[model samples]
Target: MPTRRRTLLLIAAALGLPRAGAAPEGGYRFQRGLMGTRFMVTCYHEEGELVGKAVAAAFAEADRINEAASDYIADSELLSIGKVPPGTPVRVSPLLFGLLEEAWAQAEKTGGLFDPTVGPLTRLWRESRRRKALPDAATLAKAKAAIGWKKLVLDPAESTATFTVPDMRLDLGGIAKGQAADRMLAILGKHGVPCSSVTAGGDVRMGDPPPGKEGWNIGVRNRDVDRNAAELVLRNKAVSTSGDLRQFIEIGGVRYSHIVDPATGLGLTRPVSATIIAVNAATSDALATACCIADRETGRKLAAAQGAEVFLAEG
Candidate 1:
């Protein structure tokens, strides 16, 4: 929504030569614009035609998820849920249901620090950034009143979602990309390409090592792109970074990040960046956001509790 902030994490091509038994076509990299950002899938396969099809399938899956989860889309499934009256159960696709379940679980885990129901506040923040002004107290209170993890109920048995309060909305900006990346990687694996990586905006999900390489090289960029970046070698894992580095606005000389704090009903005032590494992108993506909302010590504990690692920097 905010011009798709440049990802703090960058992928560096592995330096190793192709190993024995590797595909003769070497590797393939495909890119498509989706979900307000560039979605890329890099894979190794025996047949070039298969690789193209696989990438197309993966991008199609991303488009499906975006149409369902995107808040910016006028007719998105997410918006449809808000159109119904309070207490009405809205049947959702299994994919949307699964993503809501993950987001809900993370919200509970973070004690509401990472909430998908903060759509009201997000809307206000987006407008605030555009106008370079903060919302009035009354308006801010109204938006905050409509946000709470408990207000939205997910019924897995029925694959339905119910809202207990009026004017409630859903925003999956934090976790949808990760879920899409995970699904894309799975799709690639199904196409006989077990060694692959999917980058959806800031979320990166990778499977297996590239040919002979031990792992993919991921470079975590600093606030100053001119500075040296920290790199990590990882495989069969996922990493995500959330921060105010690029997506921020200055109002009345105060810097406001795009990430909203549910407790305050406003964008975070501090300069913070959080990168999380976990078994999958969904976990890492949600954790990275929660990490940014918390202090460094609490952020580390939050990641640790989820069996993830956090690299948090605050100023």
Candidate 2:
């Protein structure tokens, strides 16, 4: 086998599948680092070469999504929306337009708790975390002023996005990975690899169960413990976990999570983990973040309204 093929086949062995056990017989796994994290695709197919091609195509699709929607990328289509003059319609790719549509719908469903307009605040908190301090009142206030889901206008007919407020950046960190994983899974299915799972960080989108298994076994981690708090068996569904478990910083002996609550314009101070299971990865991913920011009862209600389930754990 060539070096590239060897590396693709070795990803399954080297990194190991998350507590889901080995891929079924005739399964092929591929992994690559994309969008600031590891993206793994495992598919069961009779032909090894075909599996390799399908996984490669899936990764390619993931890369495309990252290029189109990444907030971290200076020239991404998503960031380009911020560069346009305020209130000017900026035509975007159909993919980005559809994604923004979904995000807008999710924001409305969650009553602005899942706002993509939280980008300004996200950047501010990111800098604060790096410096091990909180943003000053003026800075936080400025960021908050730029937020508000209503300020985003999506014209479906023109396939454009318009920002009504200046500095109205969009951070899709809470939802973009799920969308990428969903697209990768679709790519695998189109390639005749239906029994597959795409794992992008904490987001997992499963297509069909392994050859003999009833469903994929996914482990949900607790906020405080190293071990998984729950093991779920699911198929043809998506699951995402968002929390401060590992992504947090301590300032003045108080820990703050990387997840910023749009309501407060600051990272969440409470140690909580939110897991959302829904029909698709994007819904689950965004809901997981919203659930983390909401109180337990409200979180459950929020997920339930969207035909999703929420599991909340606090340390």
Candidate 2 displacement at residue 46 in angstroms: 0.3
The candidate scoring highest on TM-score is 2
Give lDDT tens digits, candidate 2, residues 228-290.
Answer: 889999999999999987888889888888899888898899989999999999999999999
Give the Cα lDDT of each candidate.
0.84, 0.86
What is the per-residue lDDT of model 1 for residues 160-263, given as tens digits with 9 covering 90 to 100?
99999988999999899999999999998998888898888888999988888999888876465565357999999999989988898899999999999999
**Residue clash pairs of candidate 1:** none
List the lowest-lDDT window of 10 residues for candidate 2: 12-21
* Candidate 1: worst-modelled 10 consecutive residues by lDDT: 1-10
TM-scores for all candidates: the values are 0.91, 0.92
